[model samples]
Target: MAYFSVRNITKRYAAHTALSNVSIDVPEQSIFGLLGPNGAGKTSLIRIINQITGPDEGEVYFGNEKLAPHHVDRIGYLPEERGLYKKMKVGEQALYLAQLKGVSKADAMKKLKYWFEKFEIQAWWNKKVEELSKGMQQKVQFIVTIIHEPSLLIFDEPFSGFDPINVNLLKDEILNLRKNGATIIFSTHNMASVEELCDNIALINNSHKILEGSVKEIKKRFKTNTYSIDFDGFTGPVNPLLPGGFVLTEDKSDDDLRQVTVTLPATATQNELLNAFMPYVNIHAFREIIPTMNEIFIKTVHAAGNHSINS
Candidate 1:
């Protein structure tokens, strides 16, 4: 059973449709990625999920039960827009936020101290939020978000202002949360992070969902039937030796290694290409090329744009 499910959700603001019949199923204890460009309704969907706003149509469910107002306690949201009180001390603000989430003051302080010490930010405990750098403030917010240990966590652009070191630190913490049984909805423009962390994803475009699936399955679905091969000891032009249905996309040589990329025609198979190339040169490595999430995101959005025009 899905840990959380959004069923045919639709949201509108005045005359503008922010989301259109969007639905997603988040599996328990897994990292789920929500992706889209600006004005693509990702934020709207998130707001609806957080119960900060309501959908005009459809319902949201946590497990087998309908979502209720009190269910907000079960979720922790770190929005894209930072919300720290600039004049307030980090530790004080964190304690207040945790208490609001229903954590006892004693437990909150204990957890906060552990987190601060772990992140090496205990020195900033008495410092005002305005005194810290953007990344530092982000770290404080992250601690508060997870302080209550909610079952569901939603993070939007969680790594927006961090250096590589801090980015990896946060990544490790997110993975640890999933391992400890928290379902995470991670929204970001960083395709590399999605590739590294997400088990599944849903891509939205112009208020509509254009793609949704497990990351590996989505990449496979978008493949262009291309393969790269590395070889050596080729004496002549290798293009002509390719099978009739194969088209060489790139060919280059570095020392004794000849690297070539080929697009397979509909009639050709990987076995056929291997059979044809093996005779021409010493095959070093041959592997099918799958599209990256970044490439897939662009192509899918472009297709969605063209679809809107054609319709």
Candidate 2:
């Protein structure tokens, strides 16, 4: 069974519909990417999961049981909008937040110390939050969020303010949390991060889920059967060898190597294309050009927009 499941959830604020019959399952100990453009109801679904607000219709399940008020303590949420008391001492604020998440003061302090040391921010513990740089403040908030070791973690743009080094540091920690059996729902606009970290993804568009699948499966499904080939010498009229169903998209030569990109018809297999090209050129390398997450996102959103307009 899925560790967390949002089942046919719908939310409305007066006349505005924020989410429309959205449903997704987060498997245990996996990194699930919650993706969408701004104002596409991603935050609405997240808020509902956090129990900051109730859904107008449908249900959420944690394991086999339905979600309840008491379940709030089991989740750790780091919102895109940072919220830390500027005037409060870093350690003091972290402890207070950790306690709110149900960790005892003593345990919170112990965990906080470990995290501070690991992040090399022990010197900043006594400093007021406002004294730290934006990235440092973000690190403090992140430490507070995970101190209690919640089962389900929701990170909405968690890497927003950090430099690349700190971003990698936090990513490593997130991966560690998953390794220790935590389920994560990561919401971000960074498609590269999604490709690197997410096991599964659900893409929302205009308050609805337009795409949902494992990252690999989704990419494969959206592939246009494109391939890239590199060859040497023997450059006879390359266009003649190209099958009727294949479209040559790009052709270039650098020194002795010739590179070409071909988009095949749906029915064409890689083997067939390879066989046809082998006789014309000394085949050096051949590879299918799978679509990137960014490409898929743009294509899907554009298609959805066109569908909406036509309908």
Candidate 3:
């Protein structure tokens, strides 16, 4: 069974549909990305999962049972917007939040101490949250979110306000959490982060899910069969000897080295392309140009928008 499942979920606000029959299955202990454009109902689905709002239709399940109030204790949420109490001391506020998630005050302290030292924020413990920088407060919130060792964690743009070093720090911590058997649902506009952390992803567009799959499988599915070959001392215009299905999209000469890009036909193979180019030039480098998550996001969203318009 999936660790978390959203089954045909729908949510509406008056006449505007926030989500429409969206469903996704998140496997156990994996980092699942909940992705979409702005106002595409990713937040709505997240709200439903958090039990902050009920869906108009369908159901969500965790483990073997249907999600219920008790399940909230096992879930942690870190929103994009910081929610720490400004007037309270950082340790006090963290302890409060951790206890709310069902940890005892004593246990919370022990855990907070470890995290505070790990993050090197022990100095901020007694300081009021209002005095800390935005990034510092985010660290506090992150510690609080996981202090109870929740089974499920939902992080919305968790890297907000973090510098590159802190971003990498948090990324490593998150990966460690998954390694320790916690399930995560990550929602973000940062496609690069998605590529690095997500094992699987569901792309929601205009209140509907348009794409969902393992990151590797999705990348493979969208491959254009394009390759860039760099060779030293290649002759001018090798196009005349090109295979029937190969389309030469780019040709560039950088001093002594020549590089060309070609799109392979469905029936063609990389070996065939290499054979055609060999003997004429000394091949120095060759690589397939796989699409990045950013490219896939843009292409898929734009395609969905165009389809909506035409239909």
Candidate 4:
């Protein structure tokens, strides 16, 4: 069952329709990726999920209960647009924010100390926010967001402005949170990150949900029957050996291996593709080319009649 669910939500601002009957089900203790291009209604849906705004039509649920303002304490949100009081001491601000989320000051400080040490920011505790770098400030924000130990966490562009090392650190922390029973709602335009982190995803385009499924399932669904074969010692024209309706897309040589990629029609299988080349060359290896998340994102968005999505 979904720990958090948005059911046919619709929202509008003035004359602009920001969202139209969008729905998503975020399973418990899992990372659910909410993906889309800018102005594709992702922010609107997130707002509804966080109760920042109510939808014009449709109901929302937090577990068995209908969504309400009281549930705000159960969710932790780290928005893309980050802010902190530049003059406030780093430790003071983190403690204040955590208390606002209903945590006792003592507990908040205890949690903050653990996280600060874990993130190697213990030295920054007494420093003013302005004295820290952008990435350092982001670390503070991340700490406060989860300090309350909310059951659901929503992170929008969580990895922004960080170097590769910091990004990996945050990724590891996110996984640890899930392992400890926090369901995460993650939104980002970085497809490579999505491939690495998301278990399930919903793609929004033109204010509608265009695709939704587990990462592995969706990738399997988007297969194009493309295969790559590596061989050497073939001294004949490539086209002559190919069976009818086979498409040869790539041919190259790397070291001692000569590789070729082919697209097979429904009438043929990998066995048939292999059989044709078996007698003529020394086969090295062969493998199917599964579509990457970025490729699937671009292809799906284009096929849905929308363009300019992040690839």
In terms of TM-score, which candidate is strongest?
A: 3
Candidate 4 lDDT over 78-150, as tens digits, reads: 9999989999999999999999999998999899999999999999999999999999999999999999999
Better of 1 and 2 by lDDT: 1
Tens-digit lDDT track for model 3 on 204-286? Answer: 99998999999999999999999999998667787885889789999988878889999999888999999998978899999
**Model 3 vs. true fold: TM:** 0.97
Question: What would the TM-scores of all predictions be?
Answer: 0.95, 0.95, 0.97, 0.95
CA RMSD, predictions in order: 1.7, 1.8, 1.4, 2.5
How many pairs in model 1 have backbone atoms within 3 A of each other, for residues 3 or more apart or on separate chains, i.e. clashes? 0
Candidate 1 lDDT at 298 equals 96
Decide which is better by TM-score, 3 or 4: 3
* C-alpha-based local distance difference test score of model 3: 0.93
Model 1 alpha-carbon miss at residue 80, Å: 0.6
The per-model lDDT (C-alpha) reads: 0.93, 0.91, 0.93, 0.92
Clashing pairs in 3: none
The model with the greater lDDT, 2 or 3, is: 3
Task: Determine the backbone clash count of candidate 3.
Answer: 0
Candidate 2 residues lying further than 4 Å off, grouped into runs, are 309-311
Q: Rank the candidates by lDDT, best first.
A: 3, 1, 4, 2
Model 3 segments more than 4 A misplaced: 309-311
